[model samples]
Target: MKKDVILELAQRLRQAGISGEVVDPEAADGLSDLDEAYAVEGATRSLALGAGERLIGYKIGLTSQPARDAFDAKEPAVGHLLAGRQLEEGRPVPVAGLFQPKVEVEIAFILGEALPGPHVTAEDVRRATVAIAPAFEIVGSRWRGGARSLPMLVADNTNAAWISVGARTEALPRDMGSTAATLSVGERTIAGSGTAVMGDPAEAVAWLAGHLLRSGSRLEAGDVVMSGTLCPPTDIKAGDHLVAEVGGLGRIVLDVV
Candidate 1:
């Protein structure tokens, strides 16, 4: 994909995001491959960073088999995470600022050391992780409904909107795969385990690091990576108070208002 084409698609995405108007990604050319989609994402990141948003970390999408099947793909996707959208524990997740809002449970890893990909393993992620916390990744798409593919999702930054992180724990469990997560919205609750995310949350981080390294990037210190979701995402609306609990970790509350 040409640089100009990438920039053009990114600008369209930015406008669609701000105006809450979903656009079709197929309308853009050269988005057929993952690399091209990533290029578009890089261009979008550049636009966001140029507009004063700081890159805090990255988001890994579709690490679980179910998630991948839903997207009609076998591999995972990655997205950039900006600083201002990082909400603290117990903070209100303002719905007024989002486009088609949804939420999912994830374990966020804050890195203490740089981990470059390709050779990065799950143990490497665990060793480099300085803190682990329960998180809610608020997802929103800038694209309208249609035959959306992984590339389209990738180009849209893996539908990243906001990240709500709870209190961080310095010690990670010996078996992160066994950690259970429950997401409650009012009376309905959805449950899953860390194993849903590639058998372990750390494994997802390792996958993202390796993917980034293959693309010539690395996960740096101070970067917070939102490992893949534990369960399917729940659609959200205004006046919805949501809580996510992770066993052995802690809980994070998000009020959609």
Candidate 2:
């Protein structure tokens, strides 16, 4: 895609209130894997980067095999988180701008200080964290039926969507990295787990911080990176009452319509 084309397409995505799906001329060359996906994510996020909005943090998903298999894809993808997506806990997730939406329960981080890039350890994240908040990532897909190609999803912002975070917790849990839990939609329980995310949530954040640093970026203070998912993402419909109770992090709830 030409520079103008890419930019225009991106605008359409933004204005449409949903990530845009593009058909790359050389689809295979556009993106080969998850790593490349983030590369494109950086390029696209640049559209919002340095625009006066501060980086909050990062979030991860697809920590479970079933979650990965749910997409029938390998590796996992990341997104450039923005403060705009941070929805208050118990608020209804706005659905007007999403397509083929879904939800994933995740542990969110509140950084205490700016994370220096080039290399950040799990300890760095722990030390910088002000609190560990529970959150629900509203995931949407570029394609119907939950399947997408590598490049397809990359240009689609890895299906980036709204993120609803629970109240902040100051007393971080001991085994926050591997705390098991359950996701509930009102009385309808959906999925549950903890260690499913990269075996450790802290490590996931560390890895992402370093990964961005290597690409000439740094994890900004107050940035909320959504690490990979703790359980398989469950599809959701409007009017559904969503609840996620990660044993160690308490629980968070949201509804959509």
Candidate 3:
């Protein structure tokens, strides 16, 4: 995609405070024709328009191998973080504004300082992390019934809608990947995964930093990063019990409605 079109779309969407039915494929020769950077920039613009703020951090979606195979993606896709969409632990995720929502378990990170991208390491992620927190993410696909194209979902903040940040755990392990944990929604076990997230949740965070740096973006201090889904995402419904607990990390709960 043309650099000008990227900024233009962002500018237009920000000014309008409304999302187009889908980016005019012709406008940028079809987003599928463009690269990932263009998609990320367009999404950044849309969010900036609709009361979106600076990207605190990013997320690496589809971390599990099974999920990776299902999506036919060799690597993880990224998404921006918005403060307005963040939710506290043990809170209900508002069903409004979400169409065909799904939920995933993840470990979130709190950065301590600015960490520019394009050349970051899992250790960099480790140094930047102040703590690990249990999290449940509400993913709303731009497509119906969870059918989302890679470019489409990437452009729509990785289908990221709302996030439930659970309690911050004790000091993080040197290698968070090996950590084992269970997830439950009000006494009922949902599913579980740990180091399964890209071999290390920090690695996923590192990938985001590098991806953004190459796109002229950077991770800032005090930013919250969604490492990625530890387990496969599950369909969600109202009145469901939603609780998540990482091995070393504690637990968090939210209501479907």
Candidate 4:
């Protein structure tokens, strides 16, 4: 894609984010490939950073096979997480500023050491981790009616919106793949295991590390990497109270207002 086209697409997406409006997915048609899509994402990241938003870490999306299939993605997608978008546990999330918001239960990995990679492994991810926490990833798409193509989705920053994290634990779980997660909204509840996220949450992080390295970046120490969701995302609305529990990690509470 041409540089000007990439910038224009980035600006369109950023404006959509600012106005809480949805842009036409066709705006991303100029992207020639996933690489170009990520270039647009990079441009949007630059725009946010230039606007004084701090980059906290990154989030991995479509780590589950079903999620990948839904978006026609061959692999997971990555997005930058901004500090300003992080919500403290117990704080109410205002739905008025979001577009098509949904929630996912995830395990957050707070890296203790940098994982600069081409050779990063799940074990390496484990070794680098200092703490893990139960988290709620509140995702929203800026593309009208949601993203229609992988390139459009990636260019929209994988629909990242906000994240509410709970307490962190330095003690590693016995077997992350076996770790269980349960999310409840009002009277309904959904559950899944860490295996849902690319067989193991750590493996998802490992995959993210390699993906980042390929794109000239790496997971740095203190970065909060959201491995992926444990189950399918659920729609959220105003006055909704959500609770997510990750066995051995603890729980996080989110109240939508």
Which candidate leads in TM-score?
4
Please list the residue runs of candidate 4 whose C-alpha ends up more than 4 Å from where it truly belongs after superposition: none
Which window of ten consecutive residues has the lowest lDDT sum in model 4? 89-98
Model 3, CA-based lDDT: 0.70
Tens digits of per-residue lDDT for model 1, 202-240: 988988887888888899999999998987888899899
How far does residue 180 in candidate 3 sit from its true spot (Å)? 1.8
Supply candidate 4's per-residue lDDT for 12: 90
Root mean square deviation (Cα) for candidate 2 = 3.5
After superposing all C-alphas onto the true structure, candidate 1 shows an RMSD in angstroms of 1.7
Please provide, for model 4 over 1-257, each residue's C-alpha lDDT reduced to its tens digit, 9 standing for 90 to 100. 88999999999998888888778767766776898989999999999999999999999999899999998789999999999889975688876656678999999999999999699999999999999998999998898888888888899899998898899999988579999888999998998899999999999999999999888899999999998999689989998999888899888898998
**Reference-based TM-score of each model:** 0.94, 0.82, 0.82, 0.97
lDDT, residue 66, candidate 4: 91
> Where's the lowest-lDDT run of ten residues in candidate 2?
22-31
Q: After superposing candidate 1, which stretches have Cα over 4 Å from the reference?
A: 96-100
lDDT of 1: 0.86
Candidate 2, residue 191: lDDT: 62
Clashes of 3: 4
lDDT of 2 by residue, 54-140 (tens): 446555555556656766657555566777767765568866545678788888887778787667777787888888878888877
